[model samples]
Target: MSEVLEGVEKAEAEAVQIREKAQSQVEEIQRDAERKARGIEQIVRTQLTKEIEALQKSVESKAKNKSQRILLKADEEAVSLEEQGTKNIKKTVDIIIKGVYAFGGGGK
Candidate 1:
């Protein structure tokens, strides 16, 4: 029965080799999947940072525009008030002059 023993030994050796090859393939696949996952994570983080920066810039621009408009409106109101005050002063001066002329007042 020497031939029977040799056949059994060869079959066991072939089985061991097949098992080792399958384990190696499984390890390689796991490593590749982990690498791809890390790459995706980095890309997402970069994109989010850019979007946040853009949003902040937009908010600042709008705020500055609103502040400028408010300042312009205040300036316009101040100018209008100054013009009215000058007109009132002129009217008062004219009235005083007319009263003095009506009376006989001559200062030399």
Candidate 2:
């Protein structure tokens, strides 16, 4: 009977050790999962930041190109108006000269 009691006590102690080991393994698994989740979150944030920057640059480039086109068109119209004004001035001067000559004011 004494030997049987010793064997029972030993079995109980072994069971307790097994339970503690299982708990420790569960805690380790939880820590590893949390670390992996944080890494994934960081990677996603970095990718989103890069994508947003690229989109902003594309928008800026398009706006710059459109503004340049508008400026070129404005310059062309200004040149056309200046040429028209010069031609009209020359015609007006010729008409005035002819009138003065007809009035016999050319000798003076």
TM-score of each: 0.56, 0.60
Q: For candidate 1, lDDT tens digit of each residue in 36-85?
A: 99899889989998999999999999999999999999999999989987
Judged by whole-model lDDT over C-alpha atoms, candidate 1 comes out at: 0.90
After best superposition, candidate 2 residue 50: deviation in angstroms?
2.0
Question: What tens digits encode model 2's per-residue C-alpha lDDT throughout 10-68?
Answer: 99999999999999999999999999998998899999999999999999999999999
- Candidate 2 stretches greater than 4 Å from native: 88-108
What is the alpha-carbon lDDT of model 2 when measured against the actual structure? 0.91
CA lDDT, every prediction?
A: 0.90, 0.91
Which number leads on lDDT? 2
Which candidate leads the pack in TM-score? 2
TM-score of 1: 0.56
**Residue range with the least summed lDDT across 10 consecutive positions in model 2:** 99-108
RMSD of 1: 7.6
